[model samples]
Target: MIRFIDLGDQILEGQSEFAWWDTISDSFEEFSGNQTWPNWKCFEEDYLLDEVREMIQDMRPLDRYKSLFPRDWSGTFVSAEDRKKRYEKGICDDIIDEDT
Candidate 1:
C-alpha cells in the first residue's frame, strides 16, 4: 500500500525507500525504511528520482478520471486541474500497489 505522510512524504509499504521532496532545500530525499542513512538525499541525476516522479505523474490523472460521472448524476464536479490542486494541498490519498 502507498501511504502519504503529513510532510509530503510518499511511503510505499514493504519498500526499502520512500520518496519526499524538500521544499526548503528544493531537492528530493529518499529515506530507507530500515533507518539506514536516514538523511540520504536523492539528487536529480539519480535514476530513482526520475522513476518516482514519472510514477506520481502517471497516477495523478486517475483521481480526476474516477471523479467523472457517467450520465445524469448531478453531484459536485471536479476537473483534472482541480485534482492536481488537491494533491498539492495534501488532501488526496491515492493508494497504489507495489507492482504498479
Candidate 2:
C-alpha cells in the first residue's frame, strides 16, 4: 500500500526538504559519464506539481529531513524507471530510518 501525505499547507508548506544519494556523490556522475545526475527526483523535467502531488498522496509530517543533497529536496531520489516502485512501495528506507 503506497500511502502519501498531502504536500499542501498541512504538509509541504511547513515541512523541511528531503534528499537522496545521487545529489551528494560525485562518483555517480563522474564515473558513470552522466555529469548531470540528480540527487533529488523533484526536479525531473517530466514531472509536474500535480504529478508529484498525485504520486505522493498519503504521507504526512513532511519535516523529517530524511535525505539531503544541495540543500533540501521536495522528494526523494527516484529514477524514472523506479517511479512505479516508489508509488507502490513508497519510501521504505527513509520511512524506516530512525536517524531522519
Candidate 3:
C-alpha cells in the first residue's frame, strides 16, 4: 500500500543509544489497530489531502523534499509562544499518545 506517513525523527536525550531517530521515523498514524515504532506518525490514506499525496506519488524522497516537508526541526523550540501555539510543551519525558 502507498503509505501516507507524517514522517518525523525525535531525539530524547539520555533515553537510549539510538534515541536520535533518522529518516523513516515512527509514523504519526496507526496500522493494524496500533502504532508501530519502525513507523510512528503515518497519515491514513483516506485522511491525507489528495493533492499532497498525489504530488508525493509523482516524486520520491532521496535526501528531503521541501513541499512534502515544510520544515525540518533544527533546534529545540522552547519559547512560550512556540510551546503554546506550535507544539505543546510536555510535563514529563514519557510520550503521551493522544487519539485524534
Candidate 4:
C-alpha cells in the first residue's frame, strides 16, 4: 500500500521549489536511477519515503513534481484526454438548455 503522509505543518511550507528530476535525484541520489524512480506497478518493490524526505530537505528544484495520481506519470492533475472531453461537452448555458 502507498502511504502518503500529509505535506504537513512540519515540512516548512514554501521553503522553495525544485525541479522534478531534482526531487527524484535527491530522494534517491544514493541509488541507481532505475531503482530510485520506478514505474507505479514496480514502485512498491523498492520505494522508501525516508530517503525521499532526506533528499527534499536539501534539494533545490521543482520543475517536475508530479501529484500522486494513480496514472500520472508526469504527475499532472488531469489527463489530456479528460480535458478534451470536457471541452467537447462545452460549458455554456446553450448546451445545458438544449438538454433541458
Please give the CA lDDT of all the candidate structures.
0.37, 0.31, 0.33, 0.32
Top model number, lDDT: 1
Candidate 4: tens digits of C-alpha lDDT, residues 1-100: 1222222122233221111122433442222234233233333322333446446434522212224423424322333444556667884223222332
Q: lDDT at 44 for candidate 3?
A: 34
**Candidate 4, superposed: residue stretches over 4 Å from native:** 1-32, 35-40, 48-82, 90-100
**Candidate 1 lDDT, 3-81, residue by residue in tens:** 2222211243223332334455555534222212112232223423344556644754324322331233222344455
State the TM-score for model 4.
Answer: 0.23
lDDT of 3 by residue, 1-100 (tens): 1232432333333221111123464434332343322221332332243344555445543223223432443333243333344444565344433431
Candidate 2 at 70: error in angstroms? Answer: 4.6
Q: Which regions in candidate 3 have their CA more than 4 angstroms from the true location?
A: 1-10, 14-59, 62-64, 77-100
Determine the C-alpha RMSD for candidate 1 after optimal superposition of all C-alphas. Answer: 17.6
Model 3's TM-score against the true structure: 0.19
Model 1, which residues run further than 4 Å from truth?
A: 1-74, 95-100
- Kindly list the per-residue Cα lDDT of model 2 for residues 26-59, writing each as its tens digit: 2221112222323334433222233444433334
Give the candidates in order of TM-score, highest first: 4, 1, 3, 2
- TM-score of every prediction relative to native: 0.20, 0.17, 0.19, 0.23
